[model samples]
Target: MVSRPHLPEDRMLVEQLRLQLGNIGSSVIPTILLALLLVWVISNDSNAFAMRAWCGITILFKLYLAWDARRLLASEISPERARRLLRRKMVINAIDGATWGSLAWAALGTTTVAGSVLVVAVLAGVAGSSMSSLAPILPVFIVFGAAELVVLGAKLWLMGDPAYDALAVAAVLYTAALLGQARNASRAARRAIGLRFENLELIERLRVETEHAQAAHRAADEANLAKSRFLAAASHDLRQPIHAQGLFLEVLARSQLSADQHDALANARATWQASAEMLDTLLDFSRIEAGVVEPQMQVFPLQPLLNKIENELAPQADAKGIVYRSRETHAAVRSDPALVALILRNLVSNAIRYTEQGGVLVACRARGEQVLLEVWDTGIGIEPAQHQAIFREFHQLGNAERDRRKGLGLGLAIAQGLARALGQPLSLVSTPGRGSVFRVALPAARAGVVAEGAADAMPGPSRAFDLRVLVIDDDESVRTGMRQLLGAWGCVCDLADSIEEAQALARAHRPALVISDYRLRELRTGAEAIAALRAEYGADLPALLITGDTAPQRLREARATGVPLLHKPVLPSQLHRAMSAVLMGRELDSSFAGLEARRA
Candidate 1:
């Protein structure tokens, strides 16, 4: 056993007394019975009184040992008082051993042979039981056992018989055995205590680690929530000015201008459009992550989807001197078409962006009940190691200079996310310097499955802009910008800041269509104003509500009103198209209806 000097002296002594407490009752009972037996077996001679007196003293000493063991068990066992307890218990046990040794002297004075043997055997029994009781405190048990055994040997030597001498030698061997047993038990007790302390330390460590992990998890969740709130607030505030600017820019585009100013304004508009597209792309990604883009899964033709991607990305490919091809197929698939289109668009855009000389191809092949749509590019083929890494956000290849024209390295990542959300298989196959093929497998539509069509959000026929429009916005800048743009489009505009003002304006000169900011004065929403105006004017009064909030809950609340929702900064053209639709008593196109899903 390993020596544990680090074990406190008082702790060891206290624990030993505790063990003695349990053994006290049993140990005392057997010894008491033996005392009575010894008295009965002794001779009734003159020395008989002496023997009985000694027995009485021995029984009294044994009782005192019992009392001490019980006291130690019941007491608080403070360290300062422990030394006194240790001495008291050891002294009592030692005196009891001497009392028991006197039994050998009493047994020798016995008249009959059986009486002497019985008395000696009783003393031997007492020594063995004492060994067990004092096992935790070996030094004390050793002292008592030695005293009893040595006195027995001395008393036996005086008996003068050779056989009696041999019995004395046997007593010596028994004492050695008792001492050995005490040592082994003490070692075992200390080892058990060591293990207990070790276990406690280990348990404490695990508890600390678990607490740290929980705290870190909570911090991360709080940080993510904070980030979402900030983005939502910033998106709203930033878009208000941007929306007003876009309207003013459109008004500027309509007026007569010199050739130089026209070219400059055209460049400015192009730049603005690019920035807006990036914002929309980022917002779309955020919406999907926020669980706001609940896909309306259905069967849609692969050909129409491919043609859309081709038409959208062809101009970019042509500008890059790359041939773009999409093979027509009646292959239909069961999935969300918008999400699928989004996935394909990113893939095609990435393919064109990466390729310098070669062309891009879009084709579908049957794979059992599914169709694998592949976007192949002859540009720079990806390395085998980078095939998976390329799909991670902000990871790029061969663009160490960080060119903006090549995009922000989110195309493949968004594509990967969308494909995973749709539960479709998207894989990449490539060999460096040859080509790369991005493949996605969609469930093939059954023979009788009818695909759903969507209403396009595209603007049509701007000549029908002679309707009376009411614009409600808390911001003066937004109201002025709206007035200028609508006036340029030849529409009469009435403006207000609150629902009451809007109502009064409408009552005086009723608006043919209502245009309002989503968040109006006094914490009232545009949906409420639109409803109040329709109630006062007519049930068929057309209305449009615009918001700049990207918060998922805000978007969901806006959609809950069954109004076609548009996020700011809304381009003037988009507002015009929505006005044209709403004035005709129609919501946005079927396509945007699913995309926006707020149209009643």
Candidate 2:
């Protein structure tokens, strides 16, 4: 047969017994001393009836002490019941005090050896009775007390006349030792109680901390979910106008006009460009803050990036009659090319906008293990105090009226964010009313590879193309603009405003490429349009989806579809690049199919 396991109730009982022992130990000496004193007084007196009465009172007092000790033990073992137990114990203590007082009177009235023995027996009985309530040891305690008395008497008799003095000293020492043991036991019990209280306090503190941490985690999760929803909705909503604007701009750029008219158109184009830049900045800042813009580090030549900056900013500086110059250096760097280019663009744009006279100069120089790309301008330089402030979002130094036309003051803020994202340090030094220099230090790359042609420079004449393209969007203006732009690019353009429209177009004429907006009217989306087109034609249609939403959910949805994604407002050059990539892929596939056909 298996032995039964100990239950929690069993453990509780054991703890209760231990606590009783501790309490008994604490009170034993005092009770013993009172007993001994009463006995000594009774032995020295001479009253038979009074001695018997004193013995009875002593027994009553000992019984009260036993009850009080039991209550104290109960309180220590289980504090939940301590208040009730303590009340009972206090009552018992009161009874004990009264009984002891009565016993003292009886001791004064009686005198006999029998009375003394009776008093001693009563005291030992009381202590034993307290212990007996917890366990079975009352008889043993009474026998032990009798044996102690017998030993004392024997020792006194053996020593004869001198033994009387020795016996007196021994009695005093025994009483003192019992009192000291009781005091020490009480102190130990109090220390244990204090430790238990401290443990309870610590547990409470840890419980509160755990609750706080859980609350924080819940709040963060909610915020993230909300952010994902916002990005999805915002991106879908914003992309429509951006996509339309891009296509419209492309159509405008292709239109023939006089130099004066072209200049006006250019200003209009700049306004669109600035608006697009602001949107891009907002999107990028959101991405960086959300920890989505992972840096793609690669070894790329720096000179080409600098050259692109010069080409892009030259016209703006010229319009302001400010000179634009770049000091070329043979340097390469390992960094995120796209992020670095963004940083440079913002710096160049700021320099062109602020400069009134001399001009802006961009230069690169070797500095130890890093290359410093610096943009220096002779403009309204920053005050030493305002240098750091300029990098904060939407901050402008001058009057609102004067700086209002320049654009939202997010350019520097975006530049700084991008710099940090790429793990590069961007620093500024300026002299008020003189000039400012903004420097970005990047890790240097090995000096062997040739630079790729500058991709950011203004595009040259369009290349001849015979590719067929389909444009699908819910917006009429977007479709019209795309039609005109693609027509100018030498591609036969088919426009559709819905999935149904796209399906009709695909059946009538098999298009080589499909470019669709993410959000459409009547609850239709770009993915749905692509699916419809593919169903009508084939699954192998080349397609690209464009959106302005920065929401993670929308991005995830787009990513899951395995379609090429471009954010709006799309630049003419970016559109061209995307188109080239799609066309190149289509050409390679066609060539492979032809080769397979011959083999078969």
Candidate 3:
């Protein structure tokens, strides 16, 4: 029976049944105490000594049952195996009960009326308790109870004296009553055990159901993650040529043309830039949700970031006649300045985008050890119920037709995610007609020159006239496009499809600035290519990496290289700014942690 495979569900029931058996076995220690009482009352004689030996052995057997019951309960004992142990215990109980019956006969000579009564009472108690303990196996209980009664009743009837004669008749009647009590106790015990096992089965069923539900949820999450990864991989490949096309358009812009041709080219550039922005938005959302946005936390003043945001978005605000204002504060904050700027940018942009006529105000104030940075705008305010809905991806207010001009409804969601990543809280307060105030609470840093930037040493627009720039990109069209763009800028340019080819060109020309695409052919990278070129020429090589990759690992790797980066589809102005910064060896945006680290 023990060799049979135990069902997983049955293990709990079996363990509980074993526990019940132990409780029933442990309860019998009181019988040992009762037997001790009998020993104290009986006289010290040869007959008494015989009863003492019998009682001592019986007490030892009862202690053995208690010891064995604990050992079984301590482990996972199968029901079939446990029942076998139960049978062994019942055998011991039968022998113990029979011993009690012989005691009355053993002490017949020395036994007084009171002594015999004590002995009979102890025997009856042990028999009754055993009946309840072994109730599940009625045959065992019958064996134990019958042994006690027949031995004691026969001994009493055989004495054949006047007092003994009446007592023997009473003994028979007493045994009958005790047997009835045992039967009742047995039924009650069986009913209670049945209910306990039923409850255990119900609990087991619920546990299995919960595990299945959890497994399904995990599978669904994994599928979503896979889709995000595929989009990231595809974005890198798509951006390369579009980036080249944008650079080619910049070259065309520098060319002299009629007003009509120039206007047509400008419109084409706008469409290309818009496409790049849309792709970038999707990439940013995926990176943030995938937990790839690692913030470069630093102690930086709020004013510089705020000023840059206002200056950058001023045109958009101006076009709508919405007054965009910034309240300057000399407050320094300990946070990722880039991320904080991103959060505020989203809030201000949303305010301006939703508003038809009213202005927007960005204010920073110190509150205790924290700074409350807020963007308050008199826009088309959100309804109370739709406040939370606005922060969800692709969720918009009043854009039922899904107009692309209003932008994807992911700006607030990205802001919220970035705030949480920075260990700050972002909240919104708004009314239907009043306006909305988007706020971020950040830890304030000690005000000092640590937030200040050093003066740039670059000789402005009047610097050097003769500059050679080397461009290495694996994409042929991008390489051709960059060569044309740089030639149009009146700079000596060297273009190549690989580092080896670029190195061959570098040896002949020894170009001053290196511009390389982040990902190259044969699993090589722009950073690696730049490092090798710099090793041969000069370690202080001014280089910039252009990439369209948005995978978290790849982004971190590019950042680690400490080379300035520009995402693909770079406009002519952005390209020139990055170039000027790289040549002069300082970031144009000095407020960012990247340039500050380079300076340090």
Candidate 4:
């Protein structure tokens, strides 16, 4: 058991008492002064007994006020309790005014002082009723003055002594005017107290709400950090098997075997490809969660990216006996070409995975100032309730029964997150068992943009990388596999496991291309490696960064360096494509030469 520090009880009690005393002293002082004035006016008659009786009443009233003050100073009171105390004080003051008024009328045969004091007490009562009901005091004052005059006239007629009659009338008038002023002052005081109390209540409420919000935000931040650490660790471990498998596959692809053995190897390769795709999706989802995925804003023809998706996904759709097609009336848009491709890839892949016999269609239409890129499929559609849910992490609808082999329900989640990060909105309309349409609506970019070398357009196969390429990463398997893949594309390959080794290789080889992993040993990263390479080789040395880190800050830094980036468990085709696009500055095929030429 742990011992906790303690606070002294006496100190706590003294602080509590100080707060209460401050409140009570402010309310009671004014009431006591008004009571004394009432007693003085009533005692101004000739009878000795009446004068002594009025004096005794004044003394007792003062004593009661002092006792109430002492009670308030002895305890702490909350706002709710303070409100109750104010109500009780109002009632007590009203009773004191009624008692003094009754005695003065009985003794002097007039209701002069009694009427005026009664009006003031009633005004205080109105103030105490609630914080906002103090408007009735002015009318009550006017009535009190009228009633006082009637009573004074009756008293003069009954006494029939002209000597003191004028003096009595004058005194009654003076007292009435004084009490009227006091009533107005008390009303103002009550209003001030009410406003102060309301402010205190508001402050306390806001404090509690702020604390609660801070706690929730802290919890979310901690969860996100833990998730990033787990993904980094898992990606590191998963790469070892993937690297080994890639090496074995390359060896198999090169050997001459019987036709049956070759077919078996192809099946094995398909299974490996599927496993790799799942891993890639998981890594991407983690990256999206960490907010490391950034959009590269460039004006590329929209047709080429959509065509790439069509080529990539058409085979899968055909194998499943489902038709796949794309149509876009507006062919050019300014945005991150790679990010848009990724979003479309996921949408088309998901469409094919769910559709058993029917087809999938990708199309675009202009909506106001935006373009609505739509992917529609005749698959098992989502329930309206699950439309938004499916976009959340690890969410799947009826996946247990359908195609668990296709994926782990992360494709749409990644797509939605990427869209949001790129400042686009991805929305869906679906009915269970009917078809679904998923749309990515983005703002239109400027028209007629071009990349480098637009004048001399040539029609040819997309230029392949013919330059020397260097690969640097801490993971040996990843480094070896990348070296083999690049070497297969007819490019000379140099490999390193750290920045120091990369710098050495850059100086010795002066390679035409550089590729490095984002995370390395001792908190060093691929960005640092790229920086070192740039310093040794010139800054415009055509470099690319490969990373498994999904943190937003790292992504921003990578983007700031103007380097092409690919997240890990890198697909063979995506790697080949990214390399060609960055190194040659040409579109993939002759048909698409016009696309790149227009962009240039």
Model 1 lDDT tens row, 1-600 = 965446676776676666666687777777777777667767487558877888788778778867766766777887777678778767766776777888778767565777777877877887887887777778778878977887888999998999889999999998898888889998887777766766776799889999999999999888877876787787788778778877888889888999999999998878776766665655565565555565667767778677767777899999989899999888888888777877888899999998888799999999899999999999889988888899876688988998988887878887888888888979999988888999999999886465545312234457747878999999888999999999888889999999999999998998988888888777899999999987887778887888877776777677777767677777766676677677777755322332322110
Task: List the RMSD of every prediction in angstroms.
Answer: 5.2, 12.0, 7.3, 10.7
- Per residue, candidate 4 scores C-alpha lDDT tens digits across 113-196 of 475455335333423321212222333233333344344445444666675476456646665655566467545654554455
* Candidate 3 runs further than 4 Å off: 1-118, 128-143, 154-221, 283-341, 352-371, 376-403, 417-424, 430-436, 442-465, 587-600
Clashes per candidate, residues 3 or more apart or on different chains: 4, 4, 0, 5
Location of the lowest summed lDDT over 10 successive residues in candidate 3: 591-600
lDDT (0 to 1) per candidate:
0.78, 0.65, 0.74, 0.64
Clashing pairs in 2: 45-111, 46-111, 231-551, 235-549
* Prediction 1 global C-alpha lDDT: 0.78
What's model 2's overall lDDT? Answer: 0.65
Q: Over the full model, what C-alpha lDDT does candidate 3 score relative to the true structure?
A: 0.74
Cα displacement (Å) at residue 588, model 2: 14
- Residues 1-600, candidate 2: write the lDDT tens digits: 954333343333334444544555555556556555555556443554554565566565565566656655555455455445444444554454345334424542244546544543553344344333322222222233334434444444444555444643554455345444444554454455545656766799999999999999999889867865775466556666766776787687778889998998888877777666656666665555545555667778887777766766798899999999998787889887767887888899888888899999999999999999999999999988898899976687675774656856877887898789888999999998999999999999865654454223334455756877888877787778778887887889898888888888888888999999876788667988898788777788888887666665455565556667677777766667667767677321210111111111
Candidates sorted on lDDT, descending? 1, 3, 2, 4
Model 3 steric clash total: 0
Instruction: Put down candidate 3 lDDT per residue, 93-121, tens digits, no spaces.
Output: 57756776777777665677777676666
Lowest lDDT block of 10, candidate 2 = 591-600
